[model samples]
Target: MSGDASHRPLDLRSDTVTRPDETMRAAMAAAEVGDDILDGDPTVRALEEKAAEILGTEATLWVPSGTMGNLIALTVHLRPGDRFLAPALAHVVEFELGGWASFAGGVPHALPWSAGPGRVSPASVRASVPPSQPYDALRDRLLCLENTHNAAGGTVTGPGEHRAVTATAKEAGLLVHLDGARIWNAAVSLDVQPAELTWGVDSVLACLSKGLCAPMGSVLGGSAEFVRAARRLRKMVGGAVRQGGVMAAAGLVALSRIELLRNDHSNARVLASGLRDLGWEAASPETNIVLARVTDAERRVSELHRMGILATTISGAVRFVTHADLSEKDIQEVIWRISSMSP
Candidate 1:
């Protein structure tokens, strides 16, 4: 369960590397299949329904990836030439390759927030709305947010913050969309229901591929009408899989195991604390991901690889993610390997 031999495969690279286990494979094999594009796969439907009920949304739709889910939601919520506001570090703004503009013809306006590590606040949202620009005048239709903001080292947006931000958007007659790809991580860290973070948002997209241990897939949830529109967009974007019960089966297993995400958070904290003890500058992880700064980022990564560990370097920091497959022993091994390297 390590990484490729060229790299020593402790694989702290990303949570996406997690593989489905025997239970997931068995579920896929036993899943009841149907033509999803036409009649709807029974397994897919069940997963969608379960997600909707869990998130307290009216309905949900399964898409191939969180990118597709977010894109589809944007397409449904906005018209061509429309604009949306989000934190400068938002995944949709920084990581998604301007898909909002290319696919949905929507414009993204960056809202300034506390730099380094912080969530967008109500005051920031209110101030970002141009004084001369009325909600309708600017053609801005949505306010997008990410929980466990990835680029910020997995910081969780609390319920109060979420309510404040969304409420401000609503006052300005704008809809709120949550890019909650790591929301389950936030829920586990905050000891709140996932619905608490998503309660007032117009639409939400949560990924099964990240911390949930699903092979691949994401679910978009909102009003029934919005989900219906997203389904059409899904097909238009070539994201409609004919018989996706195979993936949906794994998603079902992910839902059942989501409650265990706290373990990943605990492991991340332990790893971060250990790295700090080694004289590395590591942030206290609020969820499954940790970012540690080393003197020579590339050399440290190479050294870690030589010592049988895998990780990613971003903005001069090495990123590590913990998942169901990673245990406390693995975390200890990672700490030992990195500590063995001299500054």
Candidate 2:
């Protein structure tokens, strides 16, 4: 996606592929580092504090990755043998390598979802809970939601959806954990403060590495007590970075570039439109991800890669993601190339 070489094709694989810009590199070089687990790195502390403020939470803890952040939150929220509810395609259920069952000792209960990618409803939440009989276990103790849902093609979870589903979950005595790895995209698409999107959730995970272009870092935010427990779980799971200031420095730079996400959203829309023009069924993107229907998705992904465009195949569709590295011109070029591709 970079202007590295004229022959290089546009890389719409994933936003995670974005390389840190010069500003981020400079910040990392000049970072004020410390023994993070021992003495507390000032940069890491600053990043956590800023994340807490942004999410309107009492405290936050920095983790090496989004998966770790999410698992830590789940571990803190649920006890062993407990079950949690989430949409069928939620990353925690489908993508997390069964960590909820393995490490958190939690069982996943699937909820009905759809391609609108906004399928978690108040009714669905109520349905997840069983009748409160004395003999009933009421195993469902948590509810997980994803914003700008990845497998559903980066569709957004609007504030209205947040209120309805979260309120219902709380009423059913279920704590909510938001998998907000791409909440930045949902915020940009909805034109709302990030806090507004996360309000009412018991805990939230936000990533600096995706779309924001930070090399590595994700933060989980919640009440002070929740974060305190999450910090212990963080170390228990081997996520305690000793000198994490280098990554935190880039996270600071990433926060400063939040406004630019709008550009990626715009590019994603263009890619979707192009797919439609090419006779493929492409979902209208609400953020930086485009999921286009492909007759042979797996084969098409390989072909696209050979053609110099990298994309991912998921659930019988090809997913194209836009990021800081790809330009508007790059999107157009990719479209033209796809149009000329053989049937």
lDDT tens readout by residue for model 1, 1-343 = 3333334457888888888889888998999989999888999999999999888899999999999898888888888888899887788888888889888899888877653364887777777766566555657678998887887788888888889889999987789999999999898899898999996898999999987889999999999989888988898999999789989999999999888898889999999999889888888898988988777788877777777788877667888889887889889878876665764
Clashing residue pairs in all predictions, respectively, total 1, 0
Please report, as a residue range, the 10-residue window in candidate 1 with the lowest summed lDDT. 1-10
TM, every model: 0.94, 0.95
Taking the tens digit of each residue's C-alpha lDDT, what string does model 2 give over 50-72?
88888788888999999999888
Q: Which stretches of candidate 2 lie over 4 Å from their true place?
A: 1-6, 133-138
Candidate with top TM-score is 2
In TM-score terms, candidate 2 sits at: 0.95
